[model samples]
Target: MRTSLACGALMGMWLGTALAEDDVESVRARSNPAQGYCERVRGTSRAEAALEWAPEVFASVGAVNAGVAIGGNDDTPLGSPKMRVTAGLGYDFVGIYRGRTLRSRAEAECRRYQALAALQGALARGSRLGETEALQARARALAEALPQAETLVSSLREELRDGSATLEELNAVQVRLDQLRSLARDTEQARARLGLEPAVAEGQDLGALLTAFESADDQVEALAGGLRRARAWRVSLRGGYDEVFDEILDVDQDTPLFGQLTVGYNIGHLWQGKANAQAREGRRQETRDAVDSAPRQVRQLLGELRLTEQGEQQRLREVSTLVSDLEGQLREVEQLETRQVRRFRDYLLLELARLKAEQAYLGAHLKTLQSLLGGVKS
Candidate 1:
């Protein structure tokens, strides 16, 4: 079992916002690992990490209302009292509706954030499936070709390190590595355009990753050389040499070349064999640990999402049922407007209310299915 939702590493500021807002949407947004949630991606995320920041829709409403109450005036006579009350409340003024838009703004941010995450997860799952097919294809092409390619790449790298690999081979591998890097970068940009953050690569380009892999492979190879008088000893010498040149010009070109020597020894007998065996087993162990973790974490996220889905589904059902109830209530409001023309604006506002209820109901229920599958098309 993994840890609880409270301690996953992205909840501090979100929690603060939660306490500050303390509303329904706030509760929904702050439920799980919304940060580092991009770890679900194959790479690091390239999106704005602000849903975890001081995310609220309106900052001035409270202050404005506080001021209006303090001053005892309908300062917002031109607009809604709610607007006049929060206008000068001391916050970053964005536009005309800044004071009145906090709640709506916060909800929008939350929706955008969840949408970004879902897109990333969907893209990654698709990419992973593609990689699976590619791996299978590679396997078929390797009829004993696996070990052969490994040896070819290894010997080629060894030659390169020893200043013996031909330019052609080095250039070819370098090109391949560059191409992979370009592909990764392009994938990240595509995600970003979709409002998802770019996932960062843990290591460098393909060249760097391959080089590191080769270095490790070399170590593993040397280790597996087994119990024997391995000639893997490295020797360095330090000395001075003198040479004379033109005596006619009296140019004594006698410069000494001095350096140092270093030697290393390993009882290749047990050490090599043990290291080789352990390296293979250790790699498999690490992979097993990772594989075990992936779907578990994915499912956990999915479960949290499912609960939200159920709750939203319930909420939508209630809203729709209320919609039916509101149909009669709406006619009453209209009838009152006919008797009292002054009630026209309020009657229309009620109509908007009913519309919003229906719209929200549909969105909530639709999200249930969307969040469960972890796919939302923008």
Candidate 2:
């Protein structure tokens, strides 16, 4: 029988998780109209466009040279009165390096925007509408019980004046009633900001919710891309065809086309590149370390949240048991006025306790959900 009960409980939990998944999907579908608004507001669309066109933009950064030179002896020179026209093209490697860096930075921004969008979507779907409704109901119950509590306090004060009740008893009842009044007001205000929107059902599987938040290594990618660009800036290549036309030379003697290739390294930029590469490599290593440690950090956070949830659940159970006991006691002494008064007071206080316990448990549950869904922020 114990094994059967355990299996039944597990099956119920599984069903609850399945239902929660469906609820999440429903909420996501409902919120789809507002999706990507965050990215658009943040101007990531332009950054995305920049990333797409980065290669062509950088490839176009080059120099084209065209010149006319005339130099020859006017008298009996081999190519007197010679006029030469030259055209060539050259590129600077620094421009390519800068373009690559800009592209990497744009990619990093895009990744950050994606991460924020995911977080916002999770929050939108995980609305606290149900929790707010529950609080509103609690507020209504508190409101209805306030008059009864005031009547009880008045009777207690009269009893204290006639020496039928102690001052301590009167004060305790007054304090409890005051607490209930305050709690009622606070609960009423809790519903003030709630919107009428469907939300994912409570008791979602943490692992499943966590699947929505994947760790992003945008910083590492940017740094590594920078390092690559820095290392690549050491070498420069200039290859082009120069065309020259000489008026003084015959067609066979004229060098109409000359092909030249120049491969060179900037020793100055080599030193600069070494320094830049070292700095970028160091930064990349630091980012890599952080990314590697993120999983452990997330695990620690989730573990703490789970423990808090368990604690709140335990408290809710204890408060529920107390409320149940008080109800039974109140019913047992229905005909005894004095006993009923005392039992009723205890019941009212225990009812408040139960509500608070429920609130705390729900709060813990929400915290756990947010932590699991947000993961490590980018």
Query: lDDT of each model, Cα atoms only?
Result: 0.38, 0.50
Report how far residue 17 has shifted in candidate 2, in Å: 34
Poorly placed runs, candidate 1 (over 4 Å): 1-292, 332-337, 341-345, 351-358, 361-378
After superposition, candidate 2 runs with Cα above 4 Å error? 1-105, 112-170, 181-215, 218-247, 250-300, 333-378
lDDT of 2 by residue, 87-190 (tens): 44444455555555555555554554444444343345433413543554465455455655666677766777898787777666667766765675465445
The top-ranked prediction according to lDDT is 2
- Note each model's CA RMSD in angstroms: 42.1, 13.1
For candidate 2, the lDDT comes to 0.50
- Number of the top candidate by TM-score? 2
Give one digit per residue, the lDDT tens place, for model 1 in 36-125. 442332122112222222223322222121111324476543221222212111112122132223333333334434443443443354
Model 1 clash tally?
13
TM-scores for all predictions: 0.25, 0.44
Residue 377 C-alpha lDDT in model 2 = 38
